[model samples]
Target: MRFDILTVLPGLLESPFAHSILHRAQKKGLTEIHVHNLRDYSSNKHKSVDDYPYGGGSGMVMMIEPFAVCIEKLKAEREYDEIIFMTPDGVTLNQGLANQLSSVKNIMILCGHYKGIDQRVRDLYVTREMSIGDYVLSGGELPAAILVDAIVRLIPGVLSDETSALSDSFQDDMLDAPVYTRPADWKGHKVPDILLSGNTPEIEKWRFEQAMERTKARRPDLLE
Candidate 1:
């Protein structure tokens, strides 16, 4: 999969793709992530991409011209499956959405900034709008990084153990079961007996029960 992200503050997103799973995914040819500076598309002498709102809002609104031009330039190069705008009012992102996007061949994500892009830009260019959560942030650059990470890790071969992504929390609308590693009996805390029994069916059943219980206690919304 290939992801093209547009942001006014591209420097803020540099560290996210430079290490860990995302970095490895790019190296292995499983995924490609490109960050484009929105300012580059500005036509003005000062390269201004935002302006005072026509109705006199407190914060400046991103201009439509740069976004339109940037998106058009990208579309001219190759077709994108989805053009997503990251904003607080968009649909909240979840594991299921990430899973769906992992199969997409190419996508474009626009990072909303200041008061957000002009509404006309969204109506004309964006196919989907996504929010990381219910709360708002200073800008959408962080959310774009989050959305990209969520999608890229689910791509086949991006993870060393492909099944690990499959079993991640929310994949089945259930939280992951508690896990333990070496030094099973650490400071008097022993590993569960069923895990050590090597009984596959029993172990699976236990895990499911644990997940259900954990979900009920912490996030009953998923169970419903």
Candidate 2:
């Protein structure tokens, strides 16, 4: 899979894709992430990509031309499965959505800034819109990083044990059961007796029951 992120602050995203699982994914050829500077597509001599919103607004709106040029150029290279604009008003992103996107071949993420992008840009180019949550952020750079991580990690071979992503919390509409590491006994606590038991079926049943209990106590909404 490949992702092209259009942002005015490309430097802000440097560290996110440079380390951890994302970096490993890139190295292993499981995925490719490229951050494109919106300024590079600006028509103005000063490379301006944002301007005051017409009719009155508190902050500047990202202009349409830069986004259009960048997206069009990228589209020429390869067909994009989705052109997603990151905004607070967009559909709240979830694990299911990440799983869906993991199957796509190409994606273009637009990181909105200031008062957000010109509406025409969204209407003309964006195929989907997503938000990490209901809250707002200073810019979409961080959210884009988060979205990329969520989707990329679900791709086959991205994780050493591919099954690891399948068992992640939310994959089954229930929270993951509690887990314990080595030194089975720690302080006054101990690993679950069932987990230590060699009976696979019994251990699996215990894990499911624990997951259900925790989900009911925490995110009961998932059960519904």
Candidate 3:
């Protein structure tokens, strides 16, 4: 998979893709991530990509030209499966969406900054709009990083144990059951005896039941 992110704040994304699973995925050539500076596409001599809103908004709005230029340049090189815009009003991102994107070969994400991008940009270039949640953020860079992490890890060869992604919470419309590591007896608290038992079939059943209970107690909406 290949991801190209457009942002004025590319520096903000340095850490997220440089460490952990994302870094490993890049090292193994399982995925590619490229960050582009929107300013680079600006025609202004000062490289300014934002301007005061036409209707006199309190904050400057990102200009459409830089985004249009960037998107067009990328499109000329190769077809993109999705050109996503990160915004607070877009479709709420979830595990199911992540799973769907995992199969996409090429993606481009535009990160909005300041007050947000010009409306024309969204209408003309974006294939999808995604939001991490109902809240707002200073910029879309962080959410773009988050969305990439959520999808990249689900790619077939990106994870060492492919089954791990399958068992993640929300994959089956239920929360994941609690898990334990070594030290079966932690002080007075003990690991579930079913997990410690050698009976594989029974253990699996116990996990499913626990997952149901957890989902019911927490996000019952998912069950519907």
Q: How much lDDT does each candidate structure score?
A: 0.94, 0.96, 0.95
- Compared with the true structure, what per-residue lDDT tens digits does model 1 show for residues 141-185? 999999999999998998999999999999999999999897878
Q: Which residue runs does candidate 3 get wrong by more than 4 Å?
A: none
lDDT string, candidate 3, 109-172, tens digits: 9999989899999999899999999999999999999999999999888889999999999999
Query: TM-scores across all candidates?
Result: 0.97, 0.97, 0.98
Residue 211 lDDT (model 2): 97
Give the CA lDDT, 0 to 100, for residue 135 in model 3.
98
In candidate 2, position 27 carries an lDDT of 100
Q: Predictions ranked by lDDT, top down?
A: 2, 3, 1
User: Which ten contiguous residues of candidate 3 have the minimum total lDDT?
Assistant: 53-62
- lDDT-best of 1 and 3: 3
Model 2 misplaced regions, further than 4 Å: none
Better of 1 and 3 by TM-score: 3
lDDT of 2 by residue, 1-224 (tens): 99999999999999999998999999999999999999999999999999998999599999999999999999999999999999999999999999999999999999999998999998999999999998999999999999999999999999999999999999999999998889989897889888888999999999999999999999999999
